[model samples]
Target: MGNPKQKWTNEEEEALRAGVAKHGAGKWKLIQKDPEFNQYLHSRSNIDLKDKWRNMAAAVQGSREKLRPPRPRPVQDVPAVPSVPLQTPTVVPAPVIHESPADHVKDESGKDLPDAKNGPRYTELIFDALKDQNAMDISSILAYIEKMSDIPVPPNFRKPLGARLRRLVQQEKLEKVESSLYRLKTNTVETNASNQKDTWPRPHPPALYTKVGESLEEAAKTAAYKVVEAENKSSVAAEAIKELEKFSKMAEETDSILQLAKDIFDRCTTHGEILLVA
Candidate 1:
């Protein structure tokens, strides 16, 4: 015997039509899975039935509109209020004050000072001094400049130096280490070289003691000792000359030979014979 066919009642059809109208079609599976709408179906064989029902409902709605009465249009009694005139505010021009050519000349204290020919600004001189020192801190650099040159730097010059330092920091020529302390920004080559690892050839373990034919380690030690001895000798000769400079008892010929020997020793011992020819 064949199984009984599922039947959809009028109430169930109306409910489904309303559901499709409310939620649109193609989601009947979701509706069927819903606990509320499950009771409306007989066997769940009508899973594709929502699409069919929606199409039928649309056709019925279209056909029924021909028999239904049309709605009446609304009547209007009140008119819109007339717009009032708007006034735009007038704009007033601002007064300008002009100053004479003499007004801008003044010293740091804001007092009227004599107009000196502005050849080089204070900031330029400070920057030049800083550059000469390779971007040293202000105090040490000022001391060095004082010792080296007769340039007089006033106390108020710090203001211009500060301004120039700020400008150099902005331009990336110098970088501040801390407040008021700065150093020159190292070039790319310098930075890269510093970052690079030392890959130069170093003496191997065997070379340190005994290699191929000769003892390289002993030879290296001897060479290093000789270089140190030569350096010490040069230092002694320099001290002797300084001692002679203080004394009045040394003979002229003796002083001349000592100076000559000192010069020869300086060239030969200090630079390890390479500078002697030069």
Candidate 2:
């Protein structure tokens, strides 16, 4: 290969800038051919000049971005009300509907029974219950409403009250605390919403849910311990089996030696008997 590429000097850079100002950007060949700047940029090809100009442009763009001011947020426009034509007002008679006599039926003593359709306002009762206190569980809230209200508490009051409580919590008028507990939002006595940042209630998981997680973690730990215990037992059994195998090999060797001794004794007895008979 030829000599390694050389770095651009101050003179070469100044000539490049002057050539670009005269001929505009992207005219690298013309800049290289220019007689006035050619002497300084003779070693740099058109490609080198193009690359250098691109790098300088990128640096200037980065500096501009850093010094740029933040854009202002746009204001929301109010919607205009539509106009209606003036008309002569007329008095209209209200429509009346006939009521069934069964609706107003009285008890055995001829006294009108209380209307079950118009039950106590659960929302107001909950707010009243939490007015003085910071928080209360479902049971305490029910008791407070019964103690304070003039009307007798219904036997099946809990179901409807629970539904109302859920609705209020969804609307952000009330907040649920730890398991079955509830409290009014901040500044709830005067305003439905508060301006404070901490007014929004943080979610609190039920004690039962937390207990379940703890139980699961404990169960996992127990299982891991059991697995370790089983592995240790298996290792002990393997060692026992190895000892038994060694004992079996020794017993086989002893039996072979005893058989060889018995055979030698019989051969000697037979040879002596033959000698005496001859």
Task: Please give, for residues 224-266, the per-residue lDDT of candidate 1 as tens digits.
Answer: 4333333333434465654344222222222222222233333
Q: How accurate is candidate 1 locally (lDDT)?
A: 0.37
TM-score, every prediction: 0.22, 0.27
Best by lDDT: 2
Those runs of model 2 whose alpha carbons end farther than 4 Å from true positions after fitting are 1-114, 117-120, 187-278
User: Candidate 2, residues 1-278: lDDT per residue as tens digits?
Assistant: 68676777756765676565345455678878877678778798999998887665544333434555552523121111100112112221111133222121223331221212222244467788898787987767777776665343433345445655765675678899898789987754646343341132312210000001112223233233333333333434365665345334333333222222223333335445432322
The window of 10 residues in a row where model 1 has the poorest summed lDDT is: 78-87
